[model samples]
Target: MNVATARLGARALNRALLSRQYLLRRLDLPEREVVEHLVGMHAQIPVGPYIGLWSRLAGYRPDRLSTMVTNRELVRTALMRSTIHLVTPDDCMTLRPLVQQVLDRDLYTNSSHAAVVKGLDLDEVVAAGLALLDEQPRTPADLGRALHERWPDRKPDTLAYAVRNLSALVQIPPRGTWGGTSRTIHASATTWLDRPVDPAPSVETMIRRYLAAFGPASVNDVQAWCGLTKLNEVVGRIRSSLRVYLDDNGKELFDVPEGELPDADAPAPPRYLPEFDNVLLSHANRERIIPDGLSFAEWCRRYGLMMTVRGGVLRGNLLIGGLLNGIWRIDKEKKSYTLVVEPFTKVSKKDLTALEKDGHALLEFAFPKAESRAVQVLPSR
Candidate 1:
């Protein structure tokens, strides 16, 4: 196969991500299919995947996603970075085992829990935890208490963490289901989905899937998303089969041979992204979405200053014309709903008008039952 060497700057990278992630326009696809394609959205925050889907899928209904979760078609599990992600059941089965090392790294390498878990019989812990969860879904506290009784010598927290990190424990509904109370109930991915985990997981396939969704990325970028390192060998092994590029800084970037690159000057519209959306979290270098010199953690800390409402804890982000220009929040009253946009930099008068128009539309989507809707813009900080 002929390989193309395209030099992709931030805009080419930005447009590639927008097109691949279906952010440029809503795609008429099932929620499950979209979830699989993106390899899953960052779903640690409940209601995040719904808002994420709303942003990318045409005519998306919360009920469609809720039903997918309720019916066991898609699952909320610790896959990438050992964080909860909403993924199709098939992807969960394959993706979980591939990233098992990421979870293991938390237990073995991290100092916080390393000594506690050391010398502990991890196999027994996994078996015991799985047996308990097989009997019924369990909260971490409940599972920990049960394990404590069995291994009274060890801390319950350690045992619980071992079980969660070792075994493929998926959070079951009403956890991720839309418009439902989220409880911390866990079950074995094997038992809940009634499928055995893949014996051999392919790193190459995982990287390919990632590129199709979030690429023209570097080795570090893929590592950042999956939380595993030492992929220089894996990336090198597949080098010949992939198209390569260089970032403006001369960093090497890789994408699947078939990946699409939109024009660097393509027009991108305003998009409302939920807190912890993959666009912000997936890349090792987030300069395409986040402004340089500002870390994501620092940005969130500053955003907390503007947070006024008490609702879901995740802060939503605003994407205007392909760059992350601001942050936003949704406040609902008994009779009305308000969408507030707080831009990080000055938005043009024309752009502000366009933003408010989309904000009102988002308000309707977010609070369909409210009799009144309003959009407000705070002065740029």
Candidate 2:
């Protein structure tokens, strides 16, 4: 449980994260179980959750997850530092009280969100939103307008953030379902699940769950991953059970007692991750695992965007390697996808073949079945 045992070498870290994130091999477990294991699923692009499950499950079932959302087993709620996530309905309840601390912290000076919601009655807004949604779920815009009728002076934008984010709500199914493209509307999580929400549990439990999935990390990493703050004390209590290691830069990292620290020589293969993969967003220090040459910044202009979300960014698709190699976009008009791979540098024939295969799969998974089904290899300029 000391620095040396936790050193774990670099490749060891990569394998552990990939395995824990369900990327190394597809597992055969219930969809709900997987969601719980990962704490929650990263949900930026609505359909990304299905592909994410596909990449992780042994034989994936889109229906099961879709059904869960439909049946209220899973709910789409803004969570974990105010980012969207597909968490189990139970988590939605249990995690809310724990999340309030995060929202409160952001209201302070020099914070990114900076009390964008100051002077608002958070509870009243929550009740008003629930009342509007009780009749039928409404898109965020629809709900906001309805609420605005009651409070004319409030900035609808600020009011909506308070109701939708600060309170308990879910993005009903069909919005987040496979092939159901539409704007996000808000629904009351309580009404949708027909279950009373649980008060947030101790931060200690939250820290343990995060470590179970993405451990051997620092307190800062946990905060970054969850978008929560004020947890140094929870870390202190768990320190006895954790093993610590110094990063290449000499910062101490903490991990679970059972977290696997594999062999330094473990070999990893190329992995095509969905947008905002937990692997990409789970660390305060992403470079610790993502090689410097392949850091996502080259692909990401902002936090949620990537050069390629589904397939290709704006006209180019990305041809990435073990690290990000480069980005690309196709020039097709309709029904056809030409591979315009712009690797970081010239790739060998073997690597080119791999890139082509990965790119093709990404396109098929990204677009509707009939559209963009064909991938033509274009001459790299």
Candidate 3:
């Protein structure tokens, strides 16, 4: 079969990402299926995935996700870029082994971590960690303190991070629940879930999963998402089984053959994404979701400056017409609630009105207790 390298424009790529991510249209699938389909939700913050699910799935309820955690159908684990994600138990078992190298690289390469763990027996540290955690779940600091008793010379933080990096651990429940606030607690995967991890992990399978969720992407994009390097060989190994495309820069993009490819001009509804949402952070080239005129790197700079200089700076995202056009946040007062939109570019009058309507709907979904609600579109800088 000939692998034709079709060129895709910015909007074409944008629509494809939205469709793949389930942002273009809400699905009627179960919340667990939705979480599994997108690989996992970026959930360093507990409430992030709640809003993420609400934005993508119609009739999403906080209880559904919270129950998943409570019942162990889903888990909060360190995966993909070594961040906390809300992933299925199966993914937790398999994906963790696949990205073990990335976690190891992160642990060994950090100067502080390296200094403390140098010449130490990582296996013993891991064994000790599992032992301590197997006894009962403990916060990272507590784990560190317990491990420090065994290895007093090493920095406690490094010892904790070592356990985090080396072991297949899951963040225990009540920590990842909606509107829940508790100290982060962890336990070995086998102990908590009573499930064994995949003994042999495959990078090729991981690549396929990534394509299914965030596809038509280059090797760099995959690396950017998972922090794994040397994927060119992995992509090459499966190239014959994949469909290929090219970005405007002529770089090759790969996707699963059966994945949906939506029309470039398809209407994209306004979406409210929580902070550190994977749609924004998952790809090396974020142009698929970011608008045409904005520079994502520069946007990061401006966002950082504004977050420091301006109080109440919008940290989450607002997608207008399939383009990530602005930042947004909800402001609640005694009787009134406001959804503030700060656009990075000048939005058309019609789009602004649509945004207001959608923003009010989001406010209702997010904060129904308020007596009044309004969507405020701020002047663009």
lDDT of each: 0.84, 0.67, 0.84
**Worst lDDT window (10 residues) for model 2?**
313-322
Q: Tell how far residue 363 is off in model 3, in angstroms.
A: 2.1
The parts of candidate 3 lying over 4 Å away from their true place are 292-297, 303-315
- 157 Cα displacement, candidate 1 (Å): 2.3
TM-score of 2: 0.83
Over 4 Å off in model 1, which ranges? 1-4, 109-112, 301-314
* Ranking 1 against 2 by lDDT, winner: 1
Spell out the clash pairs found in candidate 2.
139-185, 216-255, 294-324, 315-329, 316-328, 316-329, 317-328, 317-329
lDDT of 3 by residue, 192-302 (tens): 889899998788988998899888899999999999998898899899999998889888899999978889988888787876688887788888876543445556676
In candidate 2, what are the lDDT values of residues 1-381, reduced to their tens digit?
244353544556666776677766567889999999999887866766786786677656566777788777887787786778888878888887678666555443324334545676777877888888899988877777887888777666656666765667888868888667667878787888887777537778888889879876778989988877767877887787777876666777787778775555554444445555666777777764555623465445532445453355323223233343344554455766554555544566776676677667656555534355544544443
Candidate 1, residue 22: how far the Cα is off, in Å: 1.1
Selected candidate, larger TM-score, 1 vs 2: 1
Error of 1 at 153 (Å): 2.5
**Top lDDT prediction, candidate number:** 1
